[model samples]
Target: MDLKEQYEKLLRYCYMLTKDVNLAEDIVQETYLRFWQSHTYKDTNKELAYLYTIARNLCMDEFRKPKLDDIEDYCELSGESEYEPEARIDSLVIEEALEQIPKDLRELIVLRFTNEMSVTDIAKIVGISRFAVHRRLKEGLMLLRRNIGGEAND
Candidate 1:
């Protein structure tokens, strides 16, 4: 697949991790730079994985730096009035619930649901077994349900 296809997804992933749109853009830029600079794109099939791995690493590095409270928050919610009120409310609730879960779980859930990655791909990126990814995803869903005050795994 084309690397551009993964661009927005990687940016969104980094933004969620860093909570700063400008920093997310910078991180994604570094991701692309490193990918190009390292010649890792020679194998086209693994390019997406490589790009994601690079982005994930950069996001982790972002966590190591001194944080500034002046950074602006990047909320993904759309302000379009065309969206149904109930749907908007539900989205807000789910987003808030997602924020409450552990970062690892939230990332897994986002990788699966938002990025549409398979368990194997997630395992490769996370350096974990498929079983662990499944377990974390299941546990994340349970926690999200509880946070939203719904039945478990509902």
Candidate 2:
């Protein structure tokens, strides 16, 4: 894989971490910088996974800072109404519900759905077992569904 492919994969992973396009781009850029400096591109196949790990760590570090209010303000200023009103409302509700989830579960949902990573890959990235990834994905989805006022059959 070339740099462009690496970047695209990294961008998707970063977007999963941040859920904001601009922030995702920024994280991808930072991932490239660290990757280049670390000289971890000898094997192109590993590049995507390596970049994801870097981006994930960076996003976790960012989350560690006490900036919940800042994130809320940013989300508000982005204007939820700019999109279709009904969809926007639903999105806001879902996002708010996601915020209530613990970071571990939320990360699982983002990795599974937003990044479209396989359970094996997510387990490798997160240093967990494949079974654990599946459990987390199932539980996270159920939590999200419940929080968003959707019925959970199981």
Candidate 3:
């Protein structure tokens, strides 16, 4: 993908991580800036993973800051007219279900399904083993299914 497309995807991923639009944008910009400023930009093959690592680290830094407010307060309802009501409802339902799961599992679920990231890429981003990524993904999906009242496979 081109830089513009990659930027958009990174923005979405950061949004998923931070649950705040402005913070996500700031983190994404800093991620790109840091990527360009650092020598790690030479590796073309692992660009996305590197970008994710930077964004995730920036987000973790933000989370470490002293803040008594809840991140969920930044959540906003979409007013876009393009999506059908059922689709929006389903999205909201799934998002709500996602909120009920553990944060680590939710991150894996979002990375795998929401952002369409590969397990290997996710492993690299999260600094975990590929087998662990797969295992956690399965556990996450099962929990999501249970939360959404769907028929979960054993």
Best by TM-score: 3
Ranking by TM-score: 3, 1, 2
For candidate 2, what is the TM-score? 0.64
**What lDDT does candidate 2 reach at residue 71?**
70
Error (Å) of candidate 2 at residue 39 is: 6.0
For every model shown, what is its TM-score relative to the native structure? 0.76, 0.64, 0.79
Candidate 1 residue-wise lDDT at 70: 44
Better of 1 and 3 by lDDT: 3
In model 1, the runs with Cα more than 4 Å from the true position are: 1-4, 40-45, 68-90, 150-154
lDDT of 3 by residue, 1-154 (tens): 6677777778877877776666778898888888888655555335678778989999999889986565444344322223333447668888888889999999999888877888888999999999999999999999988988852331
Of 1 and 2, the candidate ahead on TM-score is: 1
Predicted candidate 1 versus true structure: per-residue lDDT over 22-53, tens digit per residue: 77779998988888887656653466666788
* lDDT for each residue of candidate 2 in 19-84, tens digit (9 for 90 to 100): 666777788898778878977567545545566777888888877878657777866754443342
TM-score, predicted candidate 1 vs. hidden true structure: 0.76
